[model samples]
Target chain A: MTNNTEGRSAFISGGSRGIGKAIAIGLAKSGSNIAINYTRDKEAAQETVAEIEALGKIAKAYQGNVADFEDCQRMVNSALNDLGEISILINNAGVASRGSLITDTNPEEIRKVIGIHVFGTHNLCHLLVPQMRAAERGDVIMISSVATESLSGRGAPYNMAKSAQEAIAFTLAKEEKVHDIRVNIVGPGLVETDMGKRLVKATRGVEDIRELDKGSPFQRVCQPEDIADAVVFFCSEDAAYVTGQRLYVNGGSF
Target chain B: MGELDGRKALVTGGSRGIGRAIVRRLASEGADVVINYHSNQKAAEEIASEVRKLGKKAEIIMADVSDQSEAERLATESITALGSIDILVNNAGIGATAVGRPHVATASPDDFYRLMAAHAFASHDLCRMIVPQMRESTRGDVVMISSIAAQSFGPTGGTYAAAKAAMEAVAYSLAKEERGNNIHVNIVAPGLIETDMAEMMVKFQGRVKDSINELAADSPFGRLGYPEDIAGSVAFLCSERASYITNQRITVAGS
Candidate 1:
């Protein structure tokens, strides 16, 4: 494994399962200690902690809803206290959009989706950036989606939230460049995860998640490992000079 | 130790400029490379010698990438010589200034076609020929060298920008099409790099080094991008660390 991230510590929101969990494991393999933030599912979060500890790295799990600004501060403070000077912060906690179209979707549903994705990302970056900036070696990553580039009619709330998240990332990248902090976004396409499963069920009304896999040239759904790898790359020394970039781990789908 | 050790790479236009840097960088990281050139066998051979000094295998092939038959032949020959191609970098193309500055009305239609053939068609043909063999490998990567002109083009820069835009479009499609096959495709778009091509562009614009440097100073990095800057990003994309990264475009512009 690349030692690019060795001796670093990362705070990954929603690291209990799915793409977030995979990123935690990937970072662990790169020799970084991990602080995982999960809203619920203590059992799953503990499982992740055990796996990281087995890898001979310090691991801790914090319960917090990132959508709430106060909870974000609590999570970041807890992570700093547990892990010491957090160098990497990944905004990965997100909720799937329920409504397919803007007109048909309830305003409350749109608010919820935006609250978790946009507000959650803003909360984490707002609270944790000061410490990261002080460290002089920092990485702030936003987990976005390829849907921002899509012209598809459906999934309006999801697309809007992701677009806003990317805007924030790009803006931070420029604003934080003087501080030697690298800010970027990793946008993943359809992956075989809990969110992916829900996305398929909601969008295509398909009970079998396999249906979405057929559209991909690879004839399979994107693995969470794929997204994790991209996230790790962004955090690694290999990308030290790469800033204000958006890397999509969509396996070639637009 | 380099992260790309034991990999076999083929870089088109690997004789000089960004392609040469990529070839050298990959070799330093433990990958054997095939350097492809159109009419610069001497330069290609020189780079090959340099790669060999890095303790990796290096071979040179002469082929006009824009020509379908030549590109197809090069792919087949490269695979046979290197056993397999784990990474392919499509970096061969004509300079935007080569056709001279002319509006669409006065511009030769043939020039636009030539640009398309060199930038877009060549990449497509090579990917078609090489992807099958690449799929057989555990990890495969393809990097297309595009330009920032694709995003912002001047009046006379239409052909070059259009061709690059088309190349990017192809890259995006190929990325989705080949993801299931365990192949990762990406684009590296450079902005105002200090290369021979950039030199020609500067001369065409009647711009001197002082003016260019002033422009560079205004950029985030306070300088023009170097070939190595682009090469380093390509190297990262080719490594196992970038395994989950596919269908992405990383612009190596200073800003």
Candidate 2:
């Protein structure tokens, strides 16, 4: 509803569905054109583009695997060509690790999860940050998880990947200050997205996330839009002086 | 209409410096405010007039919040004036230089207690008195204006750092305790803003020969932070845009 980011464009990885889609829409609502990146689900990506277009903003979908540097390069070039110099990068693509102890987990599963979360984030930043440095201002937001804080057992891959992502955020925040680029981490707790539902169903044996509301802070599970709100804030001018900060959107609970 | 239209707020130390900037920023966002000051009635009234010019109701209340009885009275009087306080900003505190920053070994217990009472205990008392009523409102926000010293704890800053650290602990705990009640508690820790307090600190430390301007020229942004810079983050934290954020510290230090 606020045109806080007017004339700016954002490139959001894994923006076809779930939390990524919510962030794409939130940025659009804040008056930024969008380039949505998706590895699969072209239809979902197209639908998101249309939704953003309906808001009177430009939107396009790019197919890319963020884990691969070449794919990220190609997508970044295509997105820049279509969207005209994106200044906001939302590294929201992530994969959950299978809940297995390190001893029982297959090494391949660990690699795949880490590749998607850690390497994917690095690939995007590597490709886009140079161009971002030239812009009047820029923002990079990492959609991390509270797993970094809990470091819960049986999810070593997820926790490690998010921690590394935050490490990059803090490091980049310091390095890019001279360029007027702000890097921040938005860590969400259990949310009501596809990934969150699967996590809850797999771990807690609950078919409906609402059933866990009694135990959750604020008597409800976090929503994808709730996480999106934080991303928008980090990108807004209201946060112009804030950088290298990590805001956990877990309703004040662990 | 502004995002905070019809909301009521009470800002401590609202007479000057960062507190004045916060009072004006919040009023501009459509919240009627009560400006709390200890000794600067003129400055408080000036900010009140500025708030009134923004088409929001503004009131000034005088109380030395470091004193428990005065803090209690401030809360009661503020609630009486504004009907209900949906937003509370704990921005009152003495400067590190004012307290004469001393190393841990040389710091007096009296100085430690004085700093603690002014920053940590004052915030704790106000939260205790006002947070219960905040629960009855649709939304509630409490922001502690902390300092980056809480983390740095640099040399000769023991008392100041301890006070800010204690305040942060209270804020983090209150954030969790009131989450179920729809209240969001956050801390905004500023780094060396260009305020009278900062000027005094810089002068007292003799960091520069003449002015903070010389120091600002060498700073990261090529300029020292302004009170408005801190106010921006505070305004955002109190807005609906930050509804999902709690128990977080946003350092407005131009990292």
Candidate 3:
């Protein structure tokens, strides 16, 4: 599109790889600076920063576990210091489920999944919305999953966390609209990513993730760039009037 | 070139307000257009001329969508004029409150049915008339121009809100039913926009309490929405960029 994102800054969690990295690149392509958060994977996070720098945009990486409230506060404050007044916030850090039914899933695994997806999303919004309001404009996005709608019996933890995340986004959309902040959810289905590969290997016993792409009407799995495009649209001037919406990037698949 | 390089579209209520803006935006994006208007032939023709100026084909048809048979006729005429209908925007409706002030207790039953026929029934009729044609295309889009009133549930806007809510529910169901055919059904719900419809609401509210200017001041953005604001969102949804997006409700209402 256009370089309308110039002078804007964004903070995205889990920006080391997969969908988050693609979003970082997409925003940078539109001329926005980035502050990326990663729980571990310092090497991958650094590589993301390098890629953004290669594209002539400023970027830096921070270490934090978004599930912990204190870590979120620290990362957000540091990101503001690094990138100056964050205009966009993406709560994307998450862990995939172990594909256990509700009764069979371990309590600790459930807690971890909920902690990362639900609490992590709230923590970032709680920390960043005030500054966004002070500035009088901002965009917040939650990376949810189409699993919420499919309600796969084996994905209870992931479904519970993602469904909860969407509810939070809807409520915040109403609450933040008065302040000129737009909140939205981008729910991708069966995207070809590291997590998608892992899920397929565990569930379908397949090594190649591309095999899961067959059933979509489009005859392909969703790519990280596909989801990234939706995020960029929601963060763009074109979406100024759009808020509290959940866009499903599922390639016409159920 | 634009996103809708070879697409053809039909927009109901294209004479004025948000519908007119959608017609303009789609034309600007390189889509040939057919617009349906109930009574404002002058305004409809004017928009058609503007669309032609954008180097696109444009036609204006006269049909009151609130009539089921008339809506079907309009759909038939739209396809005839445009050659194919790749995009259908359900934007026509009786002005939101021509039915009268909002209290359910005081609201007339006839007014409720009239509003329902104008908003929900008209959309349902048009969707049924056009989906078969849409299925023949490689990609098809249907956008329901709803209202935030459906979600807000304001006391005075019960009939209007109920009609919009029913339309949204229908849109969601249609999204599921039509996904296999590659037809995307979505909703665009605009908040308080600056239009003749909003002006009417202001005048009706004036008798009860506030002035028109106060209504403008109500948005968190410090102003009412321009027609282009809603049109921009609709244009995005109609583009290929939104192929992966379906069964969604986007509100063009600023916070």
Candidate 4:
């Protein structure tokens, strides 16, 4: 996080909904200009922009596939155009496949998971690190999943990719230490969102999920704002010297 | 605007250590401050002196917060002087002993109770007295100065840990009950702080400087915390930057 977010602009991927949107609104509330990316979901993206603007911060919407390297670069350029420097980057866009064994997983879903979670995060950092290097401060937030270390995921592709995401993140944290840029990952548990609702619907109910969540001392399903609050905290001066950290905002759920 | 411009702040135990650091942090952010001290009138006045140099109005008051009545009195006086408190930091706390003597059969129950009274009970009293003002204005911040002992289960820290643990519970209850008022309450727990208490702990605990330094270097931030480190969290709680944050504890562990 930059020491001051007043004149800074944050670029958030998949900010149209879920925790990403909550983070966008949060940063806007902190007086940071915003640039949000959505893949052809113009209405959703525009709605996000409106909310950000309502907080009295400038916001622009970008249409780009965050998973593709070239398109990720384009999104960065667009955000930079929208606001001269993209100071904070939220690599939140992701796709979670239904539980499928590694052997049974479709090749397409494998490609989708790897492309979005790994390459997408890599693409943005490779392009944006130079600017943060120049500015002497920046933040990169990777929205990882509990599947990375949890017993719940049957989707091997997602679990494997997210696990790899942390390795890449730690590597970047080591590399970016000199630039005073922080790279951290926020690993979340079951959150109530469109993706979560879909997972619940496909499961037919949220009882077991709720029961598993209550197993934690917190006794509640993780909310999108819970994850968003972590991102906000990570970007605040409270984390000025915090880097290379993997903070779990998973409501005490192991 | 500065994050704390024109905000009214009350800092307990502002005479020394982390409390003094918080006073400097808030004053720099444009808040008029009231510094409360249990003793060391000279130290409290010195901190207020620095606040005034920052062009913020500051005054020092003497009161032992370990006594519930004195804590309530301190709250009342600050409310009257500051017109209303926009920020309240419960940093006034006393250690059971400056030396981290391992708990033996000889541990002092009276001293333990004093530690609990100083940190936990006084904090509760201050919260109860200040909540009405915080609720009426619908804008206030309450920051409890907890410790790593609260979260880490420190050895021989029965009194310290219990006080901090109970303080966290009280903070959550206060935050939940007053959420409608928009008041934010958070805990700032510091680990391996570079303070006199830390020096005592490190020395008496037989912790070598090199080992402590290495541990500090192991944190994500790669260093032990200065008082300013924890003060930043306190300032954030009081700022426009943290309007929606409540019922949380932020550990300023170097990492």
Fraction of native Cα contacts reproduced by each candidate:
0.45, 0.69, 0.45, 0.13
A34-94 per-residue lDDT for model 1 (tens digits): 9999988999999999999999999999998889988888888888998998889899988
Q: lDDT (0-100) at residue B169 of candidate 4?
A: 82
lDDT score of residue A19 within candidate 1: 89
List residue ranges in candidate 3 displaced over 4 A.
A1-3, A68-74, A147-152, A167-171, A251-254, B102-110, B207-211
How would you order the candidates by lDDT, starting with the best?
A: 2, 3, 1, 4
CAPRI quality of model 1: acceptable
What stretches of model 2 exceed 4 Å from their correct place? A1-3
Q: Candidate 4 on A167-232: residue-level lDDT in tens? A: 888798888776668888878767778888677767657544565454432345667877776787
lDDT of 3 by residue, B6-75 (tens): 9999999998999999999999898999989988899999999999999999999999898999999999
Query: Which candidate number maximizes lDDT?
Result: 2
Give the interface-residue alpha carbon RMSD of model 1.
2.9
For residue A51, give model 3's deviation from the true position in Å.
Answer: 3.6
Local accuracy of candidate 3 as per-residue lDDT tens digits, A125-204: 99988898866468999999888789888889999999999999999988888788889889898778899888878888
TM-score of 3: 0.90
User: CAPRI verdict on model 2?
Assistant: medium
Give residue A10's error in model 3 in angstroms.
0.8
lDDT of each: 0.85, 0.90, 0.86, 0.78
lDDT score for candidate 4 against the true structure:
0.78
Candidate 3 chain A least-lDDT 10 residues: A212-221
User: Which is the better candidate, 3 or 4, if ranked by lDDT?
Assistant: 3
